[model samples]
Target: IKQLDSLKIDLSKTAPKKENLYFKNGVLYKKGILFAKGIEKGRVLDQFLKKINFKPKSVIFIDDKLKYLDEVEKFCKKLKIKFLGLRYGYLDKKVNNLQGFICDIQHKNLKKIFCFIQLNRNGYFQIVIYFKNNKLSMLIF
Candidate 1:
């Protein structure tokens, strides 16, 4: 947080319009003459949307608390606004959240390797492993 101190991002005393939205009383409106001030928390939509003055069908409240979500649900019902909950609820089925994969072969310190298995003219099966250090080893499997 200290690194961001030099950015000089100052919020004015009034916070200009559309900058920090104001939802005073039951009736909604902005404070400034232009759309540059005030903010819409429900959608974070643009000025074109605010100018249209259209009632929204749904509103998704995003908060880190379950109690806040419950309160938002009640508000949505009273305003005739559909509510969408974006939460990671308890899973009904078991899920595996894996990040990486393990190789089928078992070699740990190898940076580069080549494997070749071939049958010689004398009917002998020979397997060769060429390592990164230009070292070659032959094995019979």
Candidate 2:
């Protein structure tokens, strides 16, 4: 929530307090949102379903891992709920490309082109690149 606030994104109009967000069997919930940290995706979905008053006509589950997608797919099948599972890989590819770019820069001209390179606390790469004319280019991701 603090992170969102830092970016000027306000949720105060509908935001629940930290205290309102509770945990049940390792799953975190705040009103309708669920954060299934360190828990099986299928079990989390089941718990969420039980909490809702009305059954959903369809569910669309997207995850970076195929294992989690499979788990949710099986659960939806057992419940006779229409489900679509999407295995998201776009970010994975982007991260891979970024890593390759970092490696290429380091191997080719680290001292000449790079002013600074850092891996921040959030695991994001912060790079300061210098052009031939001493122009600056900063990349953060």
**Pick by lDDT: which candidate is best?**
2
Query: Which pairs clash in model 1?
Result: 17-36, 17-37, 17-38, 18-37, 18-38, 19-38, 21-39
Range of the 10 consecutive residues with the lowest summed lDDT in candidate 2? 12-21
lDDT of 1 by residue, 1-141 (tens): 121246644333332334434333222434322221223333333233364565568866554336556665775676687898665444212123311221212144244447654433322233446564567644333
- Provide TM-scores for the models: 0.28, 0.54
CA deviation > 4 Å runs, candidate 2: 1-21, 95-141
User: By TM-score, how accurate is candidate 2?
Assistant: 0.54
- Residues 113-134, candidate 2: write the lDDT tens digits: 6566553333444565656557
What value does the lDDT take at residue 131 in candidate 2?
Answer: 60
